[model samples]
Every structure is written in structure tokens, then in C-alpha cells.
Target: TGGSNAFAAPEAFQTRSSSRPSPPPRPDLSSLASSAAPEQHAVSSVPEQKAATEAGVLPLYKIALCCLLTDLKINCRDSLLVSRAQAPSLPGYLDLVEALQQRVAAAAELKDVAALCSVFSGFLRNSLLPSSCSPDVQVRLLHALAEVGLDQRRE
Candidate 1:
């Protein structure tokens, strides 16, 4: 037979050509560390609380509680639900409810409905519905959401 043998000698093997390109050189971060200014470190290392205060941002949980109180007021006004009484018995609820009560009372005392509305809107935009809220609270929140939708449609 004129055909070449299927089994070649071991010495006849050849390396396959690689399609991948050589990897780029690694960056020299050691030089960057040595050259970084103290001011850069100071700015980067600012404490989160200090940064938040400077930016006039409230803590997320407080904002959520404020939104919840606003929703309760809008939907449960006839019930005259007390913030403390309505708050679900859960960790952190007491402090949040108390803070919300104080804020609402202060707003009412100042007779600043516009400011109260603004704060409520701000909080609502940032708020999250807590998984621990009672079914009653959830239903009230749904009603509040529907009211908001109707108001938006009217406007």
C-alpha cells in the first residue's frame, strides 16, 4: 500500500500552534502606593457617618420608617393610629416609630404641611417595605399606594 502508516514514530510528534495572544504585563501598583498623596488617602478614608452627615442624607432605616408613618397617616387617619401602638413589635421598630412620631408632632406643631409633605415624599422615594410588617400595615400601605396613584392621575 502506498498510504502512510497511521501510527507514526514518537520522534515524529510536533507541538500544536496556540491561537491565544501573550498576556499583557502586570501593572506596577507598588509605585502607585509610594506616590499616592496623604490628601488622597484622607479623602478616601473619610468615615461613612461623617460623609453621610456632610451630604445631608438620613440613615436608610429611618427614611423607610418615615415613609411608613406617612403612609399610615394617609390611609389610617380615621383610626387615629398611634405610631407606637401601630408599630410592629420587632427589633429597631420602637426607635424608628418614636423618631417618626416626634417628627410628625414637630411638623404639626409648626403648622408646616408643605414641609411635612416634602419630607414624606423624600422618604417614600427612598423607602423599602420591611418584610416584618404586619398584614394590617401591609394592607394600609396598599391603600396608600392606590391613593398616591389616584392623586398622580388627577394631576
Candidate 2:
């Protein structure tokens, strides 16, 4: 026992929470960590309303909804983001989310298959293709959509 020196500190230095498990690690987002918020793009009210109306119509709404759902299929392959796991019977509790999901589900009609494809292509090009993927890939998608009369570039 005298071979090694025993200079260790007393048990009073130990912490009480040392046995507790550590919290989950946070996600690392490059270049988005600063306290300064991202710049907000100003959207014109008139055009926004028009776009909303166009997307709200029976045909267009169906197309938009279907496209959105198809694109989100990858992310939601595990679970639905809009659907609640545990729900309550409260008035208008999740009406907006439910309505949106319903609209997307109702858009799967055979008559508007072309429109649905166009919407899907457009969404993939503008919203889904960029940022998450390389710029070169996004450009290729934009070109493809352009050939099909589906402009992927934002106005």
C-alpha cells in the first residue's frame, strides 16, 4: 500500500447530482446560433391574399394540399406532424391543423392528377429542394419544373 502515494481529496468534494443522467444534446445549426434574428421578408398583402385564395379553391387547394402531403411523406413517414396523438373534444382546439390535413387528404382525386403532379413538383423545387440539399440539385429541380410549365423559382 505504501508503493503509491494517497493524496486524494475527501468525499466532501463530490456533487449530489453526479449520479443523475445528463440531458439530451441540442442540435447544431451552422451560422444560425447568433442572438440576432433572421431578417423577415416583407410580403405584399394583396398578392398573399390572392395566392391564398388560389390555393384555397377546390381544384388548386386540392393540388396544393396533395403536393404538400406528398413532399412531407418523407419527414412524416414515422408520424403525422399535424395530427395529434392525444386529442380532446374541445371546440376549435385543433381546427386549423385538422382542416389543413383534411384538405390535403381530400385532394387525391383522379381528375386533377396533372395539377397534383405540378403542385408536387413546384413544392419540391422551391420549398423542399433548397437549403436541405445542395444548390446544384435545387437548380436541376427548378429546370425540370420549368420545362413542365411549373415555375419553381420564387417571384
Q: Which ten residues in a row have the lowest lDDT in candidate 2?
A: 1-10
| Model 1 agreement with the true structure over 59-88: per-residue lDDT tens digits | 443444465665554444333334435533
Model 1 local distance difference test score: 0.42
Candidate 2 ranges with C-alpha deviation above 4 Å? 1-129, 150-155
TM-score of candidate 2 on Cα atoms, chains taken together: 0.22
- The global C-alpha lDDT for each of the candidates, from Candidate 1 onward, is 0.42, 0.40
User: TM-scores of all models?
Assistant: 0.26, 0.22
Top candidate by lDDT: 1
Clashing residue pairs in candidate 2 (N, C-alpha, C atoms within 3 angstroms) = none
Candidate 2, residue 53: how far the Cα is off, in Å: 22
Candidate 1 local lDDT, residue 121: 45
